[model samples]
Target: MQTKKYTRLMLASTLVLAAHAGWASDEGTLTMGTSVNYSSGKYGTQTSTDITSIPLNVAYDKGPWTFKVSVPYIRITGPSDVVVGVGKTSATTSTVRTASGLGDVVTAATYNFYNNAEAQFGADVTGKIKFGTADSAKGLGTGENDYSVILDVYKKVNQLTFFGGIGYTALGSSAAIPLRNVFSLTAGSVFKMDEKNNAGFAYDYRQKSSATSAAQSELTAFYVHKFDKSWKTQTYLLKGFSDGSPDWGAGVSVGYAF
Candidate 1:
């Protein structure tokens, strides 16, 4: 009886935590989600759990182009970047504040470069833009314009799929950003979890380009569940390495199909 109860609890917990990210299904539909993030390292050590936001998104997959837009509302508590000198010793600290209102936005235009029955590759020109917010108590943002060129490739074998991408972002304007020329690589597998439902796990790694001495990296694990034939929900956990950004975060999202 104890073993059965433990199994039931674990299964229940997974069901409730499963979610989706990055992509939503819709020709022109919109969706939203919220997440809590933490940051640690040279600059500061902090945690922001009440950051509520939405992924205002629109997607279209047409003959040759797949267009996507993902913009979010964000609020985070972080340490202020400052150096304090006491006598002959100086210490640096990060200030904490509440950043609110409109947040970072991303738009992308992707074109298929190669596609066969089991394999495909594509390229995307993506833009990352930041909008000003009223909550300046916490460095709401550094108004900036950034662009990335992504090369994506994917393959399907039996019931498993492999996908990965490498992208480079050119950062400029506003505040000093750590990520420039970022490269991402991801791979995952899918299984028929239920007779009518599908489930899978994927792992992803990202490295960003930087002018600073230290750079940042991200490692993430994800699980996706499909409801019905056209909808999917997923959950993900991310860990950032190096510094210059958040330490850890988690999120969930829902998607619809047309």
Candidate 2:
């Protein structure tokens, strides 16, 4: 395959897995987070569109299990005919306040077959519900429920931490369950700025169940900042590869831990 061939292939694969990617810990605990996601691309002859959203997440964790629900109240937009604030498209976004109600719900449990606060090995099962509005025309939801199972591993070397997960989705017949099974590999490291601040970079590779499956990659940078004994904020920016959307986005939220 040519170079561009690989890029385009990767893009298609990423978009397929894009609708839901929980990037981190699944073990049940309690934490809250929020972020803004935006992306633009082409669907056909017409220039695709730009979407912006505010996603809110509430999660609970107990030992080696975790469950989370993300809600995104979003505005659909078409290509802009003008430019406004932040050099953003001038196109007027639709007034349709669609909801991803529990749309991106995820539940995971880890057994920690072996973990030393620096390294961990376990298996996880994830279930996603499609209760959100799926106006394929708007590219918001997949319109079906999806199931996945993965074996995960994590390691920490000083300030450098690495995490990798490999799994396969049932790929059952569902509007949301992708036509083909899926696979993922992820690695990330954290840098401590102090007792209250940490920053890091992450890289991810995802593919389908078949040999024809293209590998999609992502690059992300984020910060975890603590303001007080109980208040903190975690923020990150994720960019997809090739033709995949969500190519450019950022999010930040304040949270409290008890």
Worst 10 residues of 1 by lDDT: 82-91
Q: Taking the tens digit of each residue's C-alpha lDDT, what string does model 2 give over 1-258?
A: 001111221221221122112333444336665655454433111454455555565655455444555555555454332110111112234332232222233333333334453232223443443242333333343344446555655554554544555656543333322345566565555566777887776666655322222345567677777898667776666675633223455555565645
Off by over 4 Å in 1: 1-52, 82-91, 118-137, 174-214
lDDT of 1 by residue, 1-258 (tens): 001111111221222212111222344433232223222333233333233445555555554455555555554433443111000011343445445566555566665545564232222333333233223334434344556565655554554444555556554433333334455454444444554454554444444334332343445455566667566666655565644323555566666656
In angstroms, how far off is 169's CA in candidate 1?
0.5
Best by lDDT: 2
Q: How many backbone clashes does candidate 1 have?
A: 8
List candidate 2 segments past 4 Å from native.
1-29, 43-48, 78-103, 107-111, 117-138, 171-178, 208-215
Global CA lDDT computed for model 2 = 0.43
TM-score, model 1 to reference: 0.65
- Model 1, global lDDT: 0.40
